[model samples]
Target: MAVKLNTPIKLVLFDVDGVMTDGTIYMAESGEFCKAFNVKDGLAIELLRAHEIKSGVISGKASPALTNRCQKLGFDIIETGCKHKLPKLEQICTNFNVTADAIAFCGDDVLDLPIMERCGLSVAPADAHQLVLEQADWVSAYKGGSGMVRDFVDTLLLSQSNIGLKEIYQPLLRKIALDDLTGVEQ
Candidate 1:
């Protein structure tokens, strides 16, 4: 079934690496791995939860950090270590008792194609790979691990109802200003 954009979406699915992070993996000599996540994205999830929309993470690689972050973010589901993400997504939809048309999927790489194709609404970050971008229903202006997820969430919220645009955009602008100042300071 095709997703109806104007309807209330029940769930949002995310890809961890490129969609959540900036598509970079940091490995230390101590065998520890890390990925940077945006504070704005976290806030977005919080706002979505407040509005009764559930979120989840689906990734091809399993990372302890990702697990910890998902827990912190209060995600409804976390499916990791799955090379084929579509089956995991299907299972998630089934478990949630929601049809595929009520779900949105965001991703940024070739591996994300299958799930993206299956989702009702598909999104890709501005810096997404060519194939991923081509398949997306929306391409965010912000890069992943920056503010892409937040951007998408805000768009969804606004589409669903009237969220004061200024109120929604102000914090993001403030954060960017702070980041710019911090960069100069460093």
Candidate 2:
């Protein structure tokens, strides 16, 4: 599909399971569910904040790992255990004082169609469900749980300005380096 980012996207919302993780749930021996998040995606969230773009996540099922990731990333909105997301999207629009057209959404399953259809720009990872891929305005070259989020953010930033990808990743590289050198999470 042809790629076109919606301009002036004030809010960007993501679906958790398939869009963030690889739609896999690993249950530890303690019965706690674990999910692996990509560091590049974390950097993408930071980049969004740096650019003054609001970011959020909506998930049907809630997990402590997901909550920690969202909190650490400073997401503007985080809705979990939400079976129906359309109403949440409406509430988000009201809370942010922006219309649906100003929102960009990334989702990877059939359940996400309602919000996807309503959002200004709909995105999906390359490994997304067939139905989702068919409808998404932009499909990332990378799969979820890889670099899809970074790809989306890179495209969004590029569409909004002349900033190069290298420029966008420079700050993240410094942070990662500092964290590695100090043995402390950044």
Off by over 4 Å in 1: 1-6, 166-186
Alpha-carbon shift of residue 86 in model 1 (angstroms): 1.0
Candidate 1 — worst ten consecutive residues by lDDT sum? 1-10
Which candidate gets the maximum TM-score versus the true structure? 2
Q: Write the per-residue lDDT of candidate 2 for residues 1-186, one digit (tens) a residue.
A: 344665578889999887778888999899888888888888788888777789999988898888988998889999999989999999999989988988889999988999999999999999999999998989999898888998898898777776787787676677778879999866
Question: What local lDDT score does residue 137 receive in model 2, on the 0 to 100 scale?
Answer: 88
Across residues 1-186, which tens digit of lDDT does each residue of candidate 1 receive?
122384467899999888888988999999788989988898888767767789998888888888999999889988888889888887887788987778899999999999889888889999999999999988899898889898999888777766576676565566657769889331
Cα lDDT computed for each candidate against the true fold = 0.84, 0.87
Candidate 2 structure, TM-score to reference: 0.88
Which run of 10 residues does model 2 get worst, by summed lDDT? Answer: 1-10
Give candidate 2's whole-model lDDT. 0.87
Cα TM-score per model: 0.85, 0.88
* RMSD to true structure for each model, in Å: 6.9, 2.9
